[model samples]
Target chain A: MCTCNKKNEYIPYPAKIESVKKESFDTKTFRVRFTDKNLAESFQYKQGQFMEVSILGVGEAPISITSSPSRKGFLEFNIRATGKVTDAIHALKKGDALYLRGPYGNSFPLEELKGKNLYFIAGGIGLAPLRSLINMVMDNRDDFKHVKILYGAKTPADMCFADELEVWKKIPDTEVWLTVDKPCDAWGCSIGVVTELWKETDVHPENAVAIVCGPAIMIKFVTLALKKSGFAGKDIIMTLERYMKCGIGKCGHCNIAGKFVCTDGPVFSYEQVKAFPEKEHVI
Target chain B: MSKMIEKKKIKGLLKEAVKQWHTYVPQKHIGGDVLIAPLPEEAKELEAALDNISLADDDLVISPKDIFFPQLETMFKFKKGEIAETVESSPKLLFGIKSCDLKGILFADEFFKRDFEDAYYLSRANERLIVVIGCINPPRPGACFCTSAKTGPFAEKGFDLQLVDNGESYFVETGSEKGEEFVAKYSGFFQDESGDAEKAVNSIKAKAEKAVELKIEFQKALDLMANDDFIPEEKYKRIGERCVYCGACVYTCPTCTCFNVFDNAKGDEGTRVRIWDACIFEGYTREASGHNPRNQKWLMACRRYEHKLKYDKAKTNMSGCVGCGRCLASCPVDIGMSKFVQEITEDKKIM
Candidate 1:
């Protein structure tokens, strides 16, 4: 089959930063809209799926969609200026042009979690992906049971979506418990790791699905805490972070124990993470 | 009828073939390594500079991986935030490739197609014409065991044409439409010798089959490691400790298709290119926030073996190890797939 022709899969579409909101000191939430009207209108992705934000000369990195699917027209990414591409992203403001490819990785099984109470646990920039699913579930709040959010950050200055956490707390039929690793005048919340908050909160692990996202070390203790809190291995869902060069599965950078985090998951069950060695993945 | 190409006129045959296609032949470098490169034009003035090149030597140190998935190639040329241009590729001929390396090409194809089709690789692969030469006489020369992997000594299919050196001439078997067209165009260079081709090929195949020296328990090891049916012991830790992560085995592997893409930008104008990457490197799967998933050398080492014996098998139903023994050949630490499998399987408790 001599069908070999010029095919460039790495081609990215232009997206202009519609707006930028300072989420935290190191993190900024950028509202990006595809320059093409049709693309902007048609691009729909589930929670836990991410997009590749390309900073012209810097490179590309997989940024999980921070906005819910219900929030139409524009996509949101909460980027922490940690690496080269991200540092360049931090330099951009309103109307700045960037390139984007994909809404990749498998999404959370929203259908499976239907009728079950949701326990969302996030810390720092880890709250970005969970924010998408959080809002989506909130939009469809009547379908699900009780919704609880137990989130923590390194410090009050490091917390993202403080206003939204307050907004979610005010919503009836939902519980939001916020915490910081250390005390601050701005953050009027408990001081401890996110896992320690599990003991302080009331959670029905039997009918509740526990979703966690944060640093690797935090996830380790969090999973252990969740297991001790009566959550089954399969019941604890977490999205992973890795150095993704190609947002697609072609690049070997994001593979962990034969699983390509770019495609197979950015979202995996605690059981899946446990099957691989503790050192082989950032759960 | 199988076609025969006379041995003396082979160079002339290659010279004529080069005019039609970008033909690559295995040539010896000054350092005694056989390298695969395009046939040089016959510059009458510097003819003495080139040595007498032959196709029927040991297989080249590098496989066809470089031909399709090159070490460095531009994926796309971008301007600021948009792609300005894409690179065009030419049709190519890989001449004198052995069966194992041919299988390696197939493995690479499967790898590129998984999850996301590798555009850089598929573009080059689409324009490729493979001509396999059956290595039956000496079977293989330096560290080879294609037979155990059920890949070679001879290839039955998946090539444009298959050739066998019958001492004085080559018995050619065209396997595709492109091959048939080539045979028709170069009819003068070949003669029908199919009547004796079968008998001659079988004798060579038999000798080569018996000559393969590698005897690692590949399938046994694969089954043990599959689904964590058997966990490897302390030896794996030592194997990982000994590994310097130099990535020699990855570079030389015939079936390894891992890669990483980066951009070379000059201001706002630059190109995005994908370079060869190895899982053995700790940084390969490390996160941006300085958190590495596979922090241990033992885990990287474990991933390599699992990919060879477990993962690729589940994906393609084909053996990841071509048994070309390049991993064993190029590994500086003296630990390769063969050694890894032998040690792990030697005392593994399957229960």
Candidate 2:
């Protein structure tokens, strides 16, 4: 019986954007800290969880927590200027106060992936959520073995976290592979989809887990590719996106069959996702 | 101890009740439709309104769920970027509620208070008292299936007080401490029930249960939905093509709690509002980037029934439908949960 007064769950906490890093032409990573010092210190969240970011007079959108909890500083949100709320968020400068509620939804299974081969597959802005776990794993590199990152974008300019990707490439026992659908003159990566990175690197699914996030089609294909490369249904993990109002389960917008993506998941194994009654609609 | 009240003295008791609680009762509108609405505060208006008070078993056009979860609600008001949550409520008395509708309220009670408490609903619901009037006959004999759904014609629990119609007198059975306190507070209006009152109430309950004529294979349908690989895509397509997307079913449904939130701003000042949203709507599940997984008409149609029958039951152990027949009664297309259940269970196509 938790007696915490949850009456104000809908009301968001005011947070200030400490800094903004341009991820791409349309996406920006905001470094936010809560205005309340106590809240800033107490706030904790796992990788793959999301927050309901609100801009006054605009609206709220679900953005994944791109920063790792292990960092213990400002929280980061990789937001693309696509929706009305994101557009308003994009207009904000440093020191601008926005509102946030929740470090909601289930996070990536961290304890299970320990000491196992880790494969991070992402596409375009989908890399935002995976970056949280990627950085966490990088900080404690001894816990995992053979880290591989397979990322793809539409073009060279669409690639996000380029500096961080470079930093990750230099990590020992880690493989960072990048690809672009349409390469620029300065581009020096493979020119293909993210799944094509398997050709350039070893992708044995033995004692390994492939974490994937992307557009629905990309996830579908990636899951197929992972399975084709001898990955079991439970070995492939993916994060999903949906139109969510309440990051809690009440606002039934994010349900895929019986499971609410907001509460039951935003992260589910391919095994669990494959069993959804409306798997066709979800995947 | 149970008490009894003369059928004729209800109006007088209600008038006296208005001073203490914001009482709601079923009243007939000018258009001849009966609805559960708030009693007027003014004495003159109250008298005239009570004169039209309907105690009939006829279904209300709108369920009493609106009293707690309004179709549209203001979550918070913001001026100059500061939020002021509008959480205010007063003590209320919901009188003459049917068993099915009362069950709907009980179900909603669990939903709004589950993992996260919805302040707007709880503030009102927590302070309210429920007095359910058991129906002697099915409100909509052709549509009501409470017995099949195991929700009515009388609620087994969750009401503060229950009124069993006993010819000239009504037997008042207290269900909770609130009901006991209410009886104590208004002791003059109530009298001790005769020994025959219990036997009479039992007989009435049996009769009411038998009165429900519409009995779809509700349990079988639930089993089929839960156990079988029941993907009736073609059936959904037919129903979807016929559906006008009018949202009458979800609007009138007592258990449908899905809502959409948006900010209404006129400049620096605005309010964040949440309104009832139907799962069948195309834009309900559509992403901001123009991607929609449940985009097709059939898919939206599937989501609604599956949510009510399969998902909600799996999650809450309570089926979303209370068998009030409001969805079928309010629908223009004649597609309702009962009809869908019949269609699936009987292996027949619905026109």
Candidate 3:
């Protein structure tokens, strides 16, 4: 039996929105700071983790932390306004308050990717989680080798973090490749799916680790492409997205087989992911 | 210290218990089924409810799961965008809980305390005073196989107080200091025994063990499950076809601890509630983008048993299915833990 004396992890700390920037047609980036200065300064987390954002009356939804911890004070959540809670969040202004909890779920093992070349493949809104790691690696550029990022969306209009993409491209020793499935007048890149961009890279499989995130169908194709090119399942890491509640493992909604996605991982290697029961686990 | 209370003095003991605690006892409901429920609020309903109050009533119609892990619990409230916690006003006293039911509570306690401690469950479970009475010849004998699960016909470890029947009087033994304090509170009802205490208790246990009619080869079933010597898919498919997904088995189960959290906000006020969730439901694991992992009914059915027999045992050294037999009793399809395990361990011809 475990101790019941620890602080209740469910309690949400109040965060006031400092700024809200629209990233895509549906997604917006909300920069929030804890109401208490002490908590805002003390809170810390790693890349690829998420927080439960609540709208008091509407509900709560798990959104990835888009900002790296290296950027001190305040947090950014790239939320897609799809459901009720998110729609309520979209309606709020810069000065409104929202309940926040977490920095929950496992993160990318930084030590494993330290000396290896990093390949980032993201599509659609899947770029939200991967953006955290891309920034973190850039902040500690001396510890890593060559970094390549492959990003694709339905069209130029669907792309998120347009300003950040420019800054990412300007980072020294980093390669940025952008593509759109449908060619648009404003876009300045090749036209193909996210996996197709991998064909342009010649990074050796032995010395490189690929990080991937996308829809279930997109992940399947990307994983198959990586495996066909001799990348072992252990070397490929992706942050899995599941419908999460409690952020903690207590609420069993995030369970895949007996594995609680919220606790064991929202991030897993291809080896760990293939073990889920077929009926309940996709990607 | 050990003591005995005659069968005639049972009501007096219960009447006194009601005064000190939020008392619940095995009593006959208006429908004549014996259930463990709080003493009715109205005196008008008391007679019907207490008609069959005894140590030897039929294995309760519903197990005592809802007492702690409420089927629908308002965990916290959000008023004016600020969260407020809910507190319990009085602790609960579950009186006349049978041995099998006691083990069920113990299993729930361990499950809720795994990796993360559930404050909603622990707050109620911690302050609860369990007074379990041993089941010697359970009336619903054909429905339960608790002896095979190694949980009961009698409890050995978890309850605060245990009572055993020895002909004219009831033998009382305190399993915790709380039980000893409770005994002192009503000292007039107890009588110090003169005979060999251990021998007498052992005799009652032996008699009770013999009375258990249903037996399952639980270890063999576990081996078959571990080895993947599964029964035919069609058998499970048939069960899936018949199951209506009513979730009665989950609600009545002693150790099922799956729950869902949702915020119910209206106007400027709302509450975040944690409610019971059954794996069989389509909504349990469906993603916002409309992808479902356990979409098939057969998959949910498979997960349910594997959770009870394999996962719980591996994690906690306790079977998720304590063989309380509530699933068998409540499931409309009659496909539950007992039937599934029996199929795994028994011959195909016999099945």
Candidate 4:
């Protein structure tokens, strides 16, 4: 309705929070739909792509789309209250209006993973982006050979999607493993870093692709573990996190080497990531 | 045959130009620095004006980049919950810009239009015409190195009109259709050369190219930096140690287009604006979770050079450095791209 794309990519469309669910102390999951019904219906995004979420007079931040396209009524964002824009977004109640501009960046290679074993590895809020792909894989369960989700958090309370985890565990032939760095009295799951779960699960590189999303340090160790587990660089996929302004790549803040993360990727195979000169800075 | 205009008629041309479009020319500021600025709205006699209007003789401390990609520009305005787009543009003429600065504009044009078009920059760029004045002598002799960068003493393309000074008059050549139209419209100011001006123009161009005394191994430096593992951490640390983080290089650079967006608000009404940003700052790459990839000063220094010499060349097939030498002129510390290239290829220390 606003014709934001035609007029200016910087001009964002108004959207309202349909609902808000507290995922953690600093994180909240918001279900948002465009204020314009037609625009909402037309908006489409893939698993790992992100949107530039704006809070009118505050600012904007890049938040990954957490909702799967298969369940496409509304978009969801799991935002952490870490900076000016995100803090302002966290303060907003249900039905509060905000602005959105993207669905920018490349998404996961879902086509290549068809009929192949899928391994999803995430830590803390890292699970947010991978959740989009995980749910899509679940919806079309028959299309995939196997599904394994290894998620971890700093603490039991920091773990997100607690109820959904139970639902996913009940899905036939799908495996969901969650761990916590600091477990509570009621906790019954394994405790340690995510790599510790490598011993418990049978993660084979043969005919399987491993998708990982987490903090840089966690990603580094996960990449090493995956490599040691006989996974090739091309078989290990990871999503990156960077401070970015314009999600359309005009803003050079997200640039590394000759690649712009906003355009070239938020998702890249380990083989590609290895080729970046400043890969150490990334993961 | 090319047109020619006497050096004495420059004031008259500018005076006439202001009447037609938003005209920018190098004017001496009260601080004694020359900057490219728009003519005052109120009409004034050019000869009688106290403000010294520099015409191809003085160094303009600031390039003409700010005319299109300003230091700060408002993207949109919002009141309460309602949002609106606020893009505005008007026809403009940039007169007496140096050749290096024109090349910078051309590079910026590609950068802003690549992949996704930036409406703000493209809108302003579409309404603009460039008039470059070729340098007969290096304006900043100590810092200017347009010869090695291969972008100047006179631009080969992208200018609307290029003027080469031949002492008594200027040999005018059109690089675009807009330039031809401009010459036809302002035929009174520009006239057919009275004599064989090609010889004079060629001689002046040679003299101007020779006046740029500073040269660096720009190509070899690019080749050295081509290897991703050529991490000159020690060199970067040395340069970073001397850097004041003043952001003078980026601000003065014609090709440094990185910007940070924020909102300026009062009560419920507010405007979102993007301001020029430097990558050397720690906050430029710092994430929301307090993690920074380029947190170190040396890393920041590396990024700045790698962007200009390495990444830009690989991506756009153009070096980001125009060899305008504003970086050295503006830097409190003498860390210019020419010096950096020298350090990379010749093993000379910048500091």
**CA RMSD for every model?**
2.9, 2.0, 2.7, 1.9
Write model 3 residue lDDT over A109-208, tens digit each, in one string: 8888898888888888999999899899999998888888888899888889989888988988788888889987867787989877867766457789
The clash count of every prediction, one per candidate, is 0, 0, 2, 0
Best by DockQ: 4
| DockQ of each candidate relative to the true complex | 0.53, 0.50, 0.49, 0.56
Top candidate, metric TM-score:
4
State the lDDT of candidate 4 residue by residue for A59-80, as single tens digits.
9999999999998769999999
Per-candidate TM-scores read 0.94, 0.96, 0.93, 0.97
- Which model is ahead, 2 or 4, in terms of lDDT? 2
From the highest TM-score down, the ranking of the candidates is 4, 2, 1, 3
Which pairs clash in model 3?
A: A279-B293, A280-B293
Worst 10 residues of 2 chain B by lDDT: B224-233
Candidate 1 local accuracy as lDDT?
0.80
Cα error of candidate 4 at position A30, Å: 0.4
List the lowest-lDDT window of 10 residues for candidate 1 chain B: B45-54
Per-residue CA lDDT of candidate 4, range B1-351, in tens? 679888877777777777788888888878888888878757654444425777765788777888889999999889977877777677899988999999999999899888888888887777778999988888888799899889889888989999988777888989999999998987888888877777877788888888899988888888888777785678888888888888999999989999999999998899999999998887888888899877788788778898898889888888888999999988887888888888888876656
Against the true structure, candidate 4 reaches a TM-score of 0.97
Which stretches of candidate 2 lie above 4 Å from their native place? A1-7, A278-280
DockQ of 3: 0.49
- Clashing pairs in model 2? none
Tens digit per residue, CA lDDT, model 2, B290-334: 999887887888778888888778878888889999888888989
